[model samples]
Target: MGQDVYEELEREIALFLRRARAISKDFARAVHPELEADAYGLLIRIADDGGARGTDLADYYGIGKPTVSRQVRLLEELGLVERRPDPSDARAAFFCLTSEGEQRMERMRTARRERFQQMLREWDSGDAEQLARLLARLNVLFKTPLVDGP
Candidate 1:
């Protein structure tokens, strides 16, 4: 890619990240008045993955154990999450969303999906599908580690 193209891509990604952060904060606040903005992603991950351990979440997000533990504790205090003993490991526990959490997450997801549909209503269906596919591919690229360059 040309220098100009690379610069444009960087700019767009930066703007997207800003907007995403705002949206995530809003969504978390809507879910629970006391929900912390940074904890919103953790809630989503737990909901989507069914359940996960604090260590697992920390590893997945490339964050520190204390950070994940603090968020998980907050979620527990909010009554949005509960811990269940790991069937395979007596000493380990898995954190899962409560019914309230599931409902809140579903509502948030539905609202976001509707907003996305409205935003793309004027576009051709194929174009929207293409954008989704490309974004998914981009996410995959982010998840993959880069090899050392020569």
Candidate 2:
């Protein structure tokens, strides 16, 4: 509520976003050769949404439709995702992970979890639980506004 609190939150949030992006980029580079941040994020969104059209993905990611279209084309060329005609809407296409993509994602998620588990080796369960609770509360406190769909 205080000005000081707001400034501190802004600084902390910026640092957190930077460091988190670096870590994700590192992990992504290991899994995907020369993976762009936007492309990697699109994969995550497709995984989250079950399946989504390029227009929907652009809106969800707050990016331009042309950019989403380009990324989807690259992803398709790389065999990472498949674009199929939308069953409900014949004129639209939706993206879904390919088998190789799902396999790769599973491996990346497993490796990340293993790394976290190793780091928490000496941490008490109660401490871990407390940290999770606090982070969840913080996430709720700073939730971003959603950009309207395209």
Q: What is the lDDT of residue 122 in candidate 2?
A: 100
Q: Mind giving the per-residue lDDT tens digits that candidate 1 earns over 25-129?
A: 888998899998888889999999999988889988878999998999999999999999976786987999999999999999899799899989999999999
TM-score of 2: 0.78
Worst 10 residues of 2 by lDDT: 140-149
List TM-score per model, in order: 0.89, 0.78
Which candidate wins on TM-score? Answer: 1
Separate clash counts for every candidate: 0, 0
What's the lDDT of the predicted structure labeled candidate 2?
A: 0.82
In model 1, pairs of residues that clash are: none
